[model samples]
Target: MPFFVYGTLRPGEHNHDLFLRARTRSEEPGRMRGLVLYEGPGYPYAVEEPGGAVSGDIVTALPETYRELLAALDELEEYAPGDPRNLYERVARDAVRADGATVVRAWVYVAAPAVAARLRAEGRPIEDGDWRGPGDSRTHRRG
Candidate 1:
């Protein structure tokens, strides 16, 4: 199945290794509309808005590998699949690439409502660029 990954799970960030380890293949850029990207304390989260567009890459994994990828991601996000406090939930959503083509049947990590409320209360505005947090230069060392 195709999964939309933003944040560290994108190509060369920290969590990208995990996805690569799972043998997942990534598509070109795609976006989720109506969600504003907010910087959480440790990572990034998205909040639903009237007109927001969260962009990221779409990755496809084999059905047999989906569970493993999900498990790894859940752990990385400090979230359990069925837990209430979890910030992200797996959902079937459409992703629009830069070319304006939309891909359906993709799973995405959408920010939970509760998490969004907390972020808003903390007065964190949605960042305009890649949400890599403060002190993180965009450079990554190749292994």
Candidate 2:
């Protein structure tokens, strides 16, 4: 299954190799529209907003690792199917590849509205949509 990631789980970010690298079949740069980025304590949250866009990676997980990968990601993101503690909701959305030509339907994790409001009140909003580069101070390199 294909999924979209714009934060710590992105390539070269904190959790990429630990969770996605080995389990993925292919990876590509892509962008998801209609989501704003908010910097969290040690990460960034994807909050939906009209006319907003998020730049990220489109990762295709190997079929055999799909279920296990999703389970691990759900745990990492604190997303239980019906749990109130769920901060991010796993969903499917269209992503445009870096080349600006291809489109793919990929799973994306979005901040629940309530959580988005909380983060909005406490964290800095990344108006640019991208969560990479110097703008993301929460990211730490792997040693």
Candidate 3:
């Protein structure tokens, strides 16, 4: 499955270099609906919401790197099956391609229920949904 990454895991971000560089088959602009981006330390968290959307990339990992990448990302996001302290939950969601027509189901790290509640109550959301910002000029290399 592909992954929808909106924050530090997106191309040009620091974590992307450490974890995704040279490990993906493709990385392209995509948008995930029904989620909101919230600030979290130096990264960001995607909290589920009814009328929101988050800008990101739909990343397909190379067959050889898929398993390792999935484990690495789950660790990075602090997601563990049924873990009460988990900050995020890995979920299958639909992500729309840049053209806005094609859609693919991808793994998305959304804020855990507890985290989402807290964020909904008081966290700061990235109003534009793009973690890199509206004037972002970071170029992404497609695999």
Q: Give me the candidate number with maximum lDDT.
A: 3
Pitting candidate 1 against candidate 2, the one with the higher lDDT is: 2
Mind giving the per-residue lDDT tens digits that candidate 2 earns over 34-127? 8888887677789877889988899999999999999999989888887777888888888999999899999899997689888778867787
Query: Sorted on TM-score, highest at the top, how do the candidates line up?
Result: 3, 2, 1
Error of 2 at 87 (Å): 1.2
Task: Give me the overall lDDT of model 2.
Answer: 0.84
TM-score of each: 0.78, 0.88, 0.94
Give all candidates' CA lDDT scores.
Answer: 0.68, 0.84, 0.91
Which residue runs of candidate 2 sit more than 4 Å off their true CA positions?
A: 134-143
Q: Write the per-residue lDDT of candidate 3 for residues 46-116, one digit (tens) a residue.
A: 99998999999999999999999999999999899899999999999999999999999999999999999
- The CA-based lDDT of model 1 is what? 0.68
Lowest lDDT block of 10, candidate 3: 134-143
Clashes of 1: 1
Clashing pairs in 3: none
Clashing pairs in 1: 34-52
Query: Which pairs in model 2 have colliding backbones?
Result: 34-52
| Residue lDDT tens for model 1, 1-143 | 67777677777677778555556755566787767787755557767775777767888776777788777766766676788988787777777776887555677777777877776687465555345434554542121
